[model samples]
Structure formats: structure tokens, C-alpha cells
Target: MLVEDEHSLHAINVGRRLLVQLIETCKELENIHRIYAYVESTNLDGIHFYTMMGFQRRETLPDYFPQRASLTPDAVKLVYEIGNDSSTEAIQTFPVTNQP
Candidate 1:
């Protein structure tokens, strides 16, 4: 969920909305029980956002990202488990944003 560099969209809950929609879609599938996200270690904001959206840190992955000139070398694995009572209740509490 990459947002543009524009500051105006930064606090508009765009990322949260997209993530909730993705989770909702994933919950409809029978085989998908968990959602995993690998966020670069240096990206604290990204980590915080995912955690706020109910993803728990599973582990720190060494050299998870490719050795690209612009990419971080390490990452943290986050997981959100579905088909659970707590997760479903938490997901339902997130405010739904209207599509433009």
C-alpha cells in the first residue's frame, strides 16, 4: 500500500482502507488462513501502520529484500491470522471509507 509523495493523502486513512479491503477479500477464500507482509526494517512507519492494522511481528528476516541499490537489505515479517474470533471483531471495527 504505497501512497504518493503528496502530503495531503498522508493522514486520510487511504492505506488502512485498502488494507481492510484486502483482508475482507482474503477472508472470503477458504485456503487463506493468514496474511503475511514483509516490511523493510528501516521503514518504521510502515511497520507501525501494519501493526496498527492488526498484523503481529512474527520474526526479523535477515537479507529478506534483494540486494538492490535502493532497497533495504533486512526486513521484518508480520502476520495477520484470519478465521478467528478476535480478528474478525477487530476487522469489523475499522471505519469504512467511501470510494471516490
Candidate 2:
């Protein structure tokens, strides 16, 4: 699971490439199942990047980023499922907060 604010990195290509590399790197470590990301639906470059990386568009939350409507636009929930334990998709259920 990763949360990125596009406002910080307006460069679509950069984000795409970085994400791809991140996924690949993560896969080299543990067994990933599926990756979840929250992106503005109107982010064509972002959608294109995920699609190219073999990620399936899952759902769209109507009102996700009200402030990003005009600024961003495509506010949606993107889900990318790889395959079995060998999957490169990041696991989400792993809640790592603070303990001993």
C-alpha cells in the first residue's frame, strides 16, 4: 500500500516510472498479492502508467478529492492484482503501527 500526493510530483512520467520501479523492488523482497492506490481519476498519465504495468482499474469513488476536482480531476480507487505469492503487488492488510 502506498499513498502519494500528486501535487508534490506533478510530473506524471516520473510518478509512473517511480511506481514501476517500486513495485519491482518490492517484489524482489516478499510475496505481494495486490496493490492499492488512490489517484485522481482525471490523472490520465497515472492511469496510463498503471495500465502499462498490468494493473486493472478497480473502482471509482465519486467524491474522493473535492479540492482536486479542478486541480486534479480523476479521483478514483485503483487496484492492481498480480497473481499468487510471487505477485509483486504490495500487501495492504499488514497494519504496522507502533508496538513493543
Candidate 3:
């Protein structure tokens, strides 16, 4: 969910749509679930969006992603257990020909 709003205004909706598409697009990958990544806790909006998108907050890893612009001194990790739920079931149910 790498959303960049040069102005940081009136881009939430666009960011949301892009994020959704990003996830769905990755579904086309072969065995992509086994990948790993990291996210900072200060990303409040990201946390909200990921949570609503079914990504669960795994734990609050201190100093995970060093705080910036004020140095809060902590960060957190959120995990999205994708490709193994009702969500993926819908994708798998679709006809193979419809995938793109």
C-alpha cells in the first residue's frame, strides 16, 4: 500500500482504490504469499485501511520502523493473511478464463 500524495489532500479515495487494486493484482502471482515485508505504526491511515481490508495487527514491534519527524521511538507490524480465506475463495471460484 504505497500511496504517495504529493499534496496530502483529497487523495484518500484514490489511494484506497489503488491499494485495493494493488492487492488484487498481486493475486495473479504464483506463490506470492510466502513473501515478507515491514510497516511502521505511525502510519495511522495505513493501519485503518489495511485493517478494513482484512489485514490483522500482529504485534507492536518496538522500534520496528524508527519514528521520523519527531522520533516517537517505536513502530508496529501488521499482517494480512491473504489467499486463504473467503476472500480468496471468491477469487478461486471465478472461471479461470476470467482472470486477468
Candidate 4:
């Protein structure tokens, strides 16, 4: 559900901040231990972005997205585990080498 306009500037880390807030809210209110997202295999940029945000690729679901079948044959499932000891903490503290 987190999406930014393709034509907008992407160097501001807006998506990252929003995603972090959502994850924190989910942990606090929903008691959700993990967050999952499905991205079409054809979208290498999407996969890379999520991976940079600390999501790990779990597996590829064959023909997972029928709607995108014509454009992409499969979907990749990714997971972001949340907790005090979760590895995703690195996402918060990792230094941004380039500041816009």
C-alpha cells in the first residue's frame, strides 16, 4: 500500500520514513510480528528498493499474480520481521552515504 508517484523526487527517503512508521504502528497496535509484501518478479527496482529497506526475499510464488501474468510470470514474496532483536534495526541506524 505504500507507493509514491513515479514522477516525484525519490531521493528524500519519504517512503522509508513512512514504512518505518507503519511498521512501528503495526508492532504497537496490531501485535504484528512480521510484514509481508509481494512484488512482481519483473520489477527489479522494486525488489532492490525493498531489499535496501531491510526486507528479505523469501520465495517466488509461481503465477502468484494473475493480473500481472501478461507482464510478469511470477511474484516474489518478501518479509520484514519486527521485534526488539530483529535484524531490521540496521535499517534505522545504517548511515546514508549520500544526503539530498
Each prediction's whole-model lDDT (CA):
0.67, 0.56, 0.47, 0.63
Clashes of each: 0, 4, 0, 0
Cα RMSD (Å) between model 2 and the true structure?
8.4
Candidate 4 lDDT by residue in tens digits, 2-76: 364343556777767777887787667534566777777777777787799888989987876545324565778
Candidate ordering by lDDT (highest first): 1, 4, 2, 3
For model 1, the stretches where C-alpha displacement exceeds 4 angstroms are: 1-7, 84-100
Top lDDT: which candidate number?
A: 1
Better lDDT candidate (1, 3): 1
* 2 versus 4: better TM-score goes to: 4
Candidate 4's TM-score reads: 0.69
lDDT of 3 by residue, 1-100 (tens): 2334334543557755755675676677644442122344555655665577666666776764444554334544555544633333322110001001
Q: Give the distance in Å from residue 5's predicted Cα in candidate 2 to where it truly belongs.
A: 9.8
CA RMSD per model (angstroms): 8.1, 8.4, 10.8, 8.5
The C-alpha local distance difference test score for the whole of candidate 2 amounts to 0.56
- TM-scores for all candidates? 0.72, 0.56, 0.59, 0.69
Per residue, candidate 2 scores C-alpha lDDT tens digits across 9-83 of 545566567667767765666577677666666666656656777767788766555453244433556666655
lDDT of 1 by residue, 1-100 (tens): 3443344676787767778998998788765667777777877777787799999988988887777666677888887888634432322222111112
Q: Give the TM-score of candidate 3.
A: 0.59
Query: Best to worst by TM-score, what's the order?
Result: 1, 4, 3, 2
